[model samples]
Target: MASNNTPVSAQQPTMRRVLKMSEDEIKKQIRSTHNQTKQKLDFDPFYLFDVVKNILNPSIIVVDNIVQGKAKDMEKGNQGESSPKACFIPPCMLKRLSYEMACKVPGEEIAYETTISILRNVLSSYPWHVKAVLTLASFALDYGEFSHLADQIDSSDQLTKSLGILKQVPIVLGRQGVEKYKNSFGKLNTLIKLTLDVVECVVELEKRIDGNNTKDVPELSLAIENMSIDVFWTIITVVDCMSRICALINDKNNTQELLPFTGKITSILKSLTDQIAVCDRQIAEIKAYLKFKRDLESLQDIVEFFKKLIFVEESHNLQQATISNNELSKKTEGLRKKKVLLFFSDFDISEKVVSILKPICEEESRKDQYEIVWIPIVKNWTDIVQSKCKVNEKYFWYVVRQFSSVLGIKYVKEQWGFKDKPIVVVLSSEAKVEHKDAFHMIQTWGIEAYPFTFERERELRNREDWFGSTIDFIPDVLTWMKEEKYIFLYGGEETWIKKFEDEATKVTNDPDISSEEISIKLFNVGKTCKAKDYLGIFLKNLNKLFFSKSQKETELDTKTKEIQMLLSYMNDGEGWVVLCKGHKLVFSGNGTKVVMALKSINDGKQGLHKSTEIQVLLKQRYNEIILPVTCCKFTANTNSGWVHGDCAKCPECSQIMEMIINFKCCHKGHPTKAVP
Candidate 1:
């Protein structure tokens, strides 16, 4: 059966070729070779023409009928539906015709020209088929046999022409077709992947040419280089066209799910554009190296200025004498022709005050005739006694001298007679005060009041209500006490102290009152009382009295318990004991008197217990008690010393408590001494 089909298949191409010839030639060919055979077969000369006509132009109804028949067959057989077969000239015939057409044109240029022509027809005639055809072409350019054909042609010019054809695809498809393409699952994705594959092929070819070491093919190398650049740019253009189609879909459809993919494509485009820019910049730099050097030098100078502005040190250390007054004076001597502005404040208020003044100082410093100085005052011993001081002097100095001349901070307080902090003084170049109310001038006129002279001062002073107090004396004594943990009780009397103590004890002993609840209630009460001036002051005083009395009682009770426990086991001893009464300390040799003194101090300010006098007594007693203990003929135990644990017993009291020491007793029957 296969042998029987071979002769019939062999005759089909010959018959088609004869049919394609002119009528005269076709009849002549039939007469010359197949005359006897044709007579035996009874073949008509016009029969081939009929077949050719049918192949060239089939009926639309016949095509529709065939599609319907296939659909029915698909349903009956449960097989997948295929594309409707072409009723006109078949794809194989068209491909054969394309080859014949290429042979007619001269050179390899026909291959690229044919590709562009086919692309144009496909893009114009069939919008839906465009992506599929372009995708196939891209894949062919990547890995198919067409890649060799592409390589043979002058890629730079021919590929660019092919690219121009590809570019028209989106335009011909229009917005509606783009919308459909994007909505179709995996369509846009397939296109992007295919385009990227084409790009990769071009890049690989470029790499191969670059890696080739043979010196014989310089022209080929140069041509490949130009081709690669053109191909790269063409691919960029193709990518841009595809991206616009995707963007159109996104705009028309407004689909959120596609956003991630769209964003990725956008980022790829941006990265590609940036790479091109970098290449361009490198080329420009090569061409104009001296110009680039000059620009770079200017850029470096600008960068340095910014670095100094942003990263300059702003911290000032009070303990290390930030800047001496004499140094400030020396600095000012050079600025004698310039107007000076001095700002003074303690650390707390200085932060806010400087924020307002620093900008003005910076602006004024730009003028050659103006000089700005910051004077941070160390008002009290407590300020210095703190473990550390934070001074953002770098920020201040940067602002002061960023554009012009200015003196640094001068740590002077009493010498300048600054009673109130956050004061600003405007001075003449001769070290004479120009405007005493410099702060007020800044407040009223802002930065416009720079170089504040005596006239401006007089105008402000005259407008000021001298009799009316400009100062606001809102004393936040309670807030101060709370923050500082210092309870100051006014009118310290025995009755008042007892009354406060009773009230405090009553509140403390209340089992229902939690510590948190007590704090909240106290805060609310303070808030309410603060609204009333007289009541707030009275309440603050009362609170201090109550707290002091309660705290002292607590300390006295704890000390009494400890002393009683120690005294129980003691036979005889003369030793000084330190005791606390609120924040005050008391020292005495007589244990009984020490207990009495604590009560007296807690009772009221009776002038019976003086801190200085008690301190002196403590020194004398310490010398008498501790000096003897040090000289005593007792062998110190090296094996055991102080053990701060629950199991250890107190040596003096013989009570289960933390063991302080393990000293051998020289005097038998004497109680061992322990330091609390």
Candidate 2:
């Protein structure tokens, strides 16, 4: 078979108006050109056509037998196993059709008229696809015989050489004749292949319509509507093909005569191809809808199925979770009747958070009670996501295999109030939403925050002191807590950080300060938070803690207020410090007050005694510099799951802070500035 990739022409033009026309319009157009009474068969002619088609492109045995003077044996009985009699079609019927079709094939003088007359008179009783196939079968017979004879022209047998001369195969296969008609033979072969393709597509469409009763489907309907015009063009092109074959064999006319008909048939082939695609899509959609219906009906566990359905939309087939694609059951079977965390995010999840959660998930104590399933939400599963999934495959307790669901992402956002940030939605075995988002809880308490629920989160919040240790993600903080040391958590630009460190060193090392009674430590919160290994995940988690849905300044949960203050200091782009003495805040100040207080003590302006504790002296001086209008500003991404309240409070005095909406951008090599 010739590859369809062969171009019919440079432009590759197609029949533009045929597919767009209504059924009646197509019939009217057909009537305008070739007004002939089309044919129908009592039973499908494809059964017989298939048998004849095989003989047209016969095997080497058939070729050898035919060339060996056994051609008459084909019509009488089976010549051998490769013969047409192997099929269900009667040999006599194949003989009759081939004889009639060969007789009616158009002559060179009036090729077009004779083709139309054949369609009208002799083959008019057959269906459109049948008409096309019958003509192609007739042409294939001549093609097979001519090809075989040309192959046998140089044979040792005298009978083969004699038959080649009688058939005029030697004249066409001769050196000079070959050069003259090479392009013509190539074109005729391409047209015949293209005709076979169209006839096959037409038959396929008919079979689908009959088998599925899908003729009324819009896509298939439009395809069926255009079949008449498609079939008409195909049959005429086949006839033109036979005419070209006759001209080529007889050496009486130029094979260039088939070019115009080849172009028309190519257009018809393209039309049939496009129609088949539309029909196939419709068939697939119907199949999917039926499958979805069946799945819904067959579902034994609606809760488990609905949970699965939420993540895998209608487009994907619902099956057991495997290492290949989206499924949640098998890997999560141990977590049955327990809380399951659906970790929803885009492909860009925090590796630091994943690293922390991995050990906790693998811990034997908690393995049976809980499980986390990473459901990566994305619009399309691109290569980057695929690579990211591979990189983090072992880190997650369980993750759907290359799973991406835009609808699932939408549901997470609208129903559970998820935003640009990743969220952990907790579901009980009963499939009830235990928590809309427990991501913040996990960040705050790690494994201690087990059965991450709204009640447990509230209980944890109630237990926390307003000024307690929240930066435990850092390793040294636990040591500082054990030592009962005063830790100064501060952040600003590089210059301000250096200045505060120098001032604190001077204040702490002073002879007047009692180093034996008080231990002091300094931490650059901003710089430490952005270490490459952690990648600012600590800062994000801290921000989430502050912006959590449970956060309300008016409520007694002072940890949220402290987190708000810390984040505000970092977001302000100015030097600030908060003093924590053994996991409790002593005092907090901006650079102006904290640095000035240290300088005042260093200059002996406060008249500090030799036995005075450094932290007490520093706090007293810092308080002296405080202003009445204490403003604290915090910046957060609007889409980062921050549930907006009516107002916030100043961590300094518990005064209701005024709210203002400000948009900020921090592009590369530029300071973050607020939009006016």
Candidate 3:
């Protein structure tokens, strides 16, 4: 029932370094920093220790284990991969509380900061009874770490889940534990939110390093300067304190209050004092901006020189980037058209459909009076249009950037076509197989699928009996025809447009009605053709889908799922080593477990799976002390099954997705491997 946020008063400090400062000295430091004068300030030193001593206690490990245990239990139950989440009554007045801080709530004003992330869940938002709760809550909010508790908030059965988590804040983030996050994850900027959380924590430690608790500590600043969003204040303070301490330790002027702080205290305080003074001076200058225009003008003289060089560099980059963006935009736009649907399967209904359209499209000699459309059906397709048009792949993203950029999507969705005409979609053969669901979704509305044969049309149009004018290649010509006039529908949403079949009958009963007069136009993909060399042609065009970011979602989802599953297997219990015979050994999977397993058994990337290497090593290390964790997961290639799962419970909401794992399932619409 207990968690890390519980506050305890006074215990021997584990990472609890302490310092002593005189009342006069503390008063002077606080006054100098705040630009205020204080007379005869009195505070009880013993009581202050009583208040925070437990904060540094070693018993925090017990607190962490208790909380971690709660998490384990949450995962044991089968709620699936994440904690069971219920929709909390959406607090009507508050919206993204982090961004809403400008409203200036009362106690929050004291903790006011622009960079603070909203408390991720209720524990952080309403941390009652717990003293450290308020402080840790403040820290969590400061670094935008509220999201780490997303699983907790979402899984929360009710407000009580949050309350439970609020109880364990203190011990869970204590020095040694906190340092683990700080040193490895913090330095690398692995998780920005996590880093910010650590930054908030380190800031607390940095401000406290002086050990003069009487003075108020400044809140951590979250605004980024240049690219430096992750400098840990703890490292800065330690280095600063050591530097000054080295100089002062040689000077033997030991006093009563600081005698307790002893050597390093003097230098650390001096450095802090100097830095604060400079900051104070800068703040003063910014505050007098208007009044100091003349002085600023002097500074402007230097800025002007820097401005010219910066402008030139920025302008050049923008120009090149803009031109590149324009070309890619044109290519993606070109692919959006009322093109015909061409299938590459022989003896399929596609041939019959193309036969039907040929008389209309190719029979320019016939008075059909309708525009001919061209669509192609190719298998194993992607949304990439670069090689299909031979343009720079990078331009796709650049074109995307020309629009609004947001999380996940760098570019805003671009709508093509004018209100004056109906859009027709061309479906390729591969699309039908990949988007069978999309077809159903369209069928719900009643649209028909069609196919086309541009190869035959090209031959027919090239003959002297034709208009006697040569045209762009069939596919390229169809792409060029789209322009700002029409949008292409892919797969089945086109079927939905045909759902108004009766309306199509009512509006333009004549088969010759122009697309410009209709609200929705359905172009049935009619013909199919078998490619003589499908694989070779497909691979040659693969470059576009492989490189063009126009279809970036396809790439990102694959890579992300791959990485997630990859990390999951590494963290899973499956990647380990155990001795069965006489020696130690490593097991299946790679990365973390593989590296650690190798180190344990003195093995390398020796292609071991399902405990293969470990079984062999067991023959040699039977006499040595070893730890063993069972590995699972069976494959056809090997005669063994390896186990992989992180059976951890939800720390917040108590909901758990059993055996945390991310798999790319085709049924789930994640295509990591080939369709087969």
Clashes of each: 3, 0, 58
lDDT of each: 0.34, 0.59, 0.26
Q: Is candidate 1 or candidate 3 better by lDDT?
A: 1
Q: Who wins the lDDT comparison? A: 2
Candidate 3: residue 542 lDDT (0-100): 22
lDDT of 3 at 326: 45
List candidate 3 stretches off by more than 4 Å: 1-254, 257-409, 413-676
Task: Write model 1 residue lDDT over 1-676, tens digit each, in one string.
Answer: 0011123345446434522445355233222221122112122212322332222122212222222322212232122123323442322323432332222221112222343343334222322112223323332222222212212222367664465334332232333433444343233333344344334333333343444432322333433433422332233233333333334333333321221233333443454444444444433333343342233334323223222222222222111222223443345444556566666655444465656676676684455776665544443425442222234555444222221101112112222334434567665555556665466456544575566765754343333221011111124433433343212221223443344344334432344333223311111112234345542443233232222223334444433332332222111232223222222222212333232333444343332233333344333333333222221221111111233222354568644442222223355443223223
Candidate numbers sorted by TM-score from highest down: 2, 1, 3
Q: Write the per-residue lDDT of candidate 3 for residues 602-672, one digit (tens) a residue.
A: 33323223232333442333223233432322111110012211123346753323232223333422112
> How does each model score on TM-score?
0.20, 0.44, 0.16
Alpha-carbon deviation at 471 in model 3, angstroms: 25
Q: How does residue 512 of candidate 1 score in lDDT?
A: 35
